[model samples]
Target chain A: MNNERILLVSRPKGTPAMSDFRYEEAAVPELKGDQVLVKTIYLSVDPYMRGRMNDTKSYVPPFELNEVISGGIVGQVVQSLSSDLAEGDFVIGNLPWQKYNVVNDISVRKLDSNIAPLSANLGVLGMTGLTAYFGLLDIGKPQEGETVVVSGAAGAVGTIVGQIAKIKGARVVGIAGSEEKTAYLKNELGFDEVINYKTDNVFEALKAACPGGVDVYFDNVGGEISDAVLRLLNHGARIPVCGQIALYNLEKMDVGPRIQSQLLINSALMKGFIVSDYAAHFEEGAMELAKWLMEGKLSYKENIVEGFENTIDAFLGLFKGENTGKQLVKVAEPENV
Target chain B: MNNERILLVSRPKGTPAMSDFRYEEAAVPELKGDQVLVKTIYLSVDPYMRGRMNDTKSYVPPFELNEVISGGIVGQVVQSLSSDLAEGDFVIGNLPWQKYNVVNDISVRKLDSNIAPLSANLGVLGMTGLTAYFGLLDIGKPQEGETVVVSGAAGAVGTIVGQIAKIKGARVVGIAGSEEKTAYLKNELGFDEVINYKTDNVFEALKAACPGGVDVYFDNVGGEISDAVLRLLNHGARIPVCGQIALYNLEKMDVGPRIQSQLLINSALMKGFIVSDYAAHFEEGAMELAKWLMEGKLSYKENIVEGFENTIDAFLGLFKGENTGKQLVKVAEPENV
Candidate 1:
């Protein structure tokens, strides 16, 4: 069978273009001992991937030139070897951008579709959900009656964070790019207030929304949005730096007002973290997130594009704010199911 | 008796000038019920006082115009109307910058002169020492074998912080303005390495000193100095924002490279704190610091300018880096001693 994949041909200067990626067709090889042949079902494309495209030192290494771009993928096992034999089973792993992956069994986790939808393993039941869970609860730590302001409120992690803040009995204010996103956050997710960054003066609107001042800030889109929120922080405020989607494509380093004096005057805290830092607590975090999902306390939205040929387009769309929530590409359906 | 005091004649625009203060002679008030008379002996002039001189909201309220500039003062109780104290007792209180103060019994703590020098109550064993004790141990949390860097290393709090980090078995690096101050940090305070930020290339010297990267940063002087240190932080680094003496004199807001991306990529934590935040544990902190002092494990330095006439000069000298350690003005000596 033919295994078609996408390779990163060139690094981007600012925003990535179609020419940066090359589509290639290769023959699938026979599965060796302890290896599993899986057909890709869904693939995750995130903003952090922008960092990996550049040849720089970061949390994750930059993607090598002319190499297959790899990330979180959910697939169905077509053939397996070793004692954990499975000819038809759903699994999730960090695999290459390909239609079929011949990977070691240890890299993939067998998923039960009976618990939730298969595509959810690539989103709410996956890394995105866990990111919000740990970063908000552990770092943000919104106490009851405190105000929580979340940027990128309609995206995968921000959506969950807002709902969780509401669950904790805190006043939740969300900042997003569109009126539709603001409406969904307030009307559907029970957010106390939502600010449309594109249509409204974020600083004045935010000042009006949070009258008591911000106690916890879950930052997803850093830039002027973060700079505005920081000006209104109360004493002992906590800011969890989750993502800086705004500066992902900038050719030069970001410059802004230095915050040492602000932090010192308010005695505030700002911390940064990645999801894998909480690896030991994954089981606990996943259990709580799943419980919230089952109890209707949490609702998630996924924006999926059909076909493997459009994978690169789907990935590039993230930078343009084209997707309202988690962006994924659907490669194929489980043949056995 | 005449009670001479310094009054804030005008608010400063940037750096404070001698003209902003007025030396006045006022009548001494008679001691009332429950009131004691304290004759000021040693007066503390700190970098944080610069903020109080501005007519803006801050951690402490701005000093009222034409009022006595009140701050940490050590005095000798010359007269007492309360049974809680008697004459000849040494005490510490936040009193006006005056030759004599009429205060209530609850406002002052009587000190035992035999424990240490009376002036030590204003510096090493007092607020400055407590500031270093909590800010470094609680916020910085330097573990053994880690690299700890302290800015303003010749200042009262910075000197204590470097010594405490050394006691914790961490490699300590000090950043100061002059080679003389840097030499004091390394030779007198037992710092592992010292960088003269004025003469030496601070960024390159810091990188060489901290071969393992900075794990804990005690920031007393913030600005480009902090930016340099932030670039070299290791994974999970902790930064305690204690003071921003460098920016205290700026008339306008400070602008520099944003640090959110650096903290995010390293999973670092930066916290701003005032010594009073840990007030609940002041006794515990003082005990530990005092124990270290008595055991010869800790040493302190004070730069004293004789006479109450030089009080304003001593306070203004802080911005010019005139004093090495704790800067103080000696108003009067204990007659009984």
Candidate 2:
């Protein structure tokens, strides 16, 4: 079968553009023992993928030019050589932005749609959900009555972070890019306060919203937003940094707010977290998030575009602040045959 | 009795000069109920005193111009008016830079010289010791088989930090000002390695020492030294900031070694801690530290200058890096009694 794939054409200079990706058609190879042929159904386009596009040293390696730009995907098994994953099985795996993938079963996990929608597994029950859950509970340690301030609150991870903080009984303040996103955080996600960062003076608004100073700061959008929150952190504040979307788009020293002195004076506890770091704790985190989600105690939304060809556009949405929640590409409907 | 005192005279414009203080003699204070007329025996010289000298907001209040500078002191009870303390009792308490003080008995804690030595109560066995213990364990949380790096390694608090990290089965590396101090950390204090910040490229030396990348960073000194260490942190690293001796004397804005971006990429944690924040857990921390002292599992040194009049010289030694361990002014010898 012919497979359509998105390959990294070049390393982005700044704000990863659609031109950096090249769409092409390739031949699907035969599955080896213990390998399953996965037909991509829902391919996730996340901000972290931007990190892999750069050759700079980080937690993970950069994606090579001319290679398929890889990421997590919810796929249907069209052919399987391994008994562990039979053909027709719906699985979630690191299947990349592709129409088809010949991958090992070990890298794939079967998801039951009856338990929750399979796509919900990609949005809230997958890495994104685990990221918010563990990062908050383990790092943020949100206690009831404490205030949690999250930047990028309208984004996928930020939305769930606010919800998780809400479930933990902490007061939540969300900072987003637009009026619409700010309203969504307050009315739909139950954030105690919402700051339209693009419109308001973030420092003054955050100070007024979290008058007592924040106990937990979940930083998704770093830079000036982080600097503003840093100034308002109470002594012994915990900052769980999961993303730095603001800095990810820098061409050269894009300066807004410098936070070094504020970091020293506030004496804030700033810790960065990658979801994979808590792999051992994922099961516990997922189960709790799943329970809260099923009970209607949690709410989530997605910005999913249709077609594999549109994967680059979905990935590029992060920098523009265009996508409200987990941005995914629904490449195809699940095939039963 | 005549009371001799050194008044603040005037707050220093920047780095304090001897001219900022003036010596004067007056009648000894008369004792009141629950009060004791104590003779200043050891006038403690510490970095935190710099905060008090400045007319600005800080953890403690600034010293008023023309008032005797307040500091931690080892004093002898000269005349007692309370049952809690008595004459000839050597104690550690807050006292002014004066020959005598009419202090409340409740304000001082009696020192048991037999536990180690009376002078140690002013250094390692006192506030500095508790600061190192609580900050490292409570905030830094060094675990076994980890690489623990401590800045200001020759200072009172930094010395204990290296030893405690060693006790926890960590490889300890310390950063100090002089070769003598560096040698003392490796040979005398038993630190695995020590870097002399005066002559070495601190960042390069740090990279060489901690090839595995730093795990627990107990920082008594902040600034570029911290910036250097921040870059070398492994994922899941912890930085417990107790003090910033380097920034204490900063005349202007820093020009180099920016660190915030490095911290974000490392997924490391940097936290600030005032020892008193964990005062509730201090009794328990002090108990363990005392055991380490008695078992010969810990070692400390002091840079003691004789005479109460020499307190300014002792304070100046901190900036000069003249003291090897805890720096103190031995105000009055017991023979005077």
TM-score of chain A of each: 0.98, 0.96
lDDT of 2 by residue, B122-145 (tens): 777878899898878877888898
In model 2 chain A, where is the ten-residue run with the lowest total lDDT? A254-263
Top candidate when judged by TM-score against the true structure: 1
Residue B96 CA displacement from its true place in model 1, Å: 1.2
TM-score of 1: 0.99
* Cα error of candidate 2 at position A250, Å: 2.6
Please report, as a residue range, the 10-residue window in candidate 2 chain B with the lowest summed lDDT.
B253-262
Off by over 4 Å in 1: none
Per model, state how many residue pairs clash: 0, 0
Predicted candidate 2 versus true structure: per-residue lDDT over A1-337, tens digit per residue: 8988988999998877778889999898988879999988888988887888888877678899989888888998888898888888999987667798999999989988787877888888999999998888888999999999998999999999999999889999999999899989998888999999988999999989998888999988777787778777776678888888887777775444334444445566778878888899889888998899889998889998998877787788778999898888899998767
Best by lDDT: 1
Per-residue accuracy of model 1 over A71-142 as CA lDDT, tens digit each: 999998888894574878888999999999998899898998887889888788899999998999999999
Q: In angstroms, how far off is B314's CA in candidate 1?
A: 0.8
Please give the lDDT score at residue A310 for candidate 1: 93
Candidate 2 scores a chain A TM-score of: 0.96
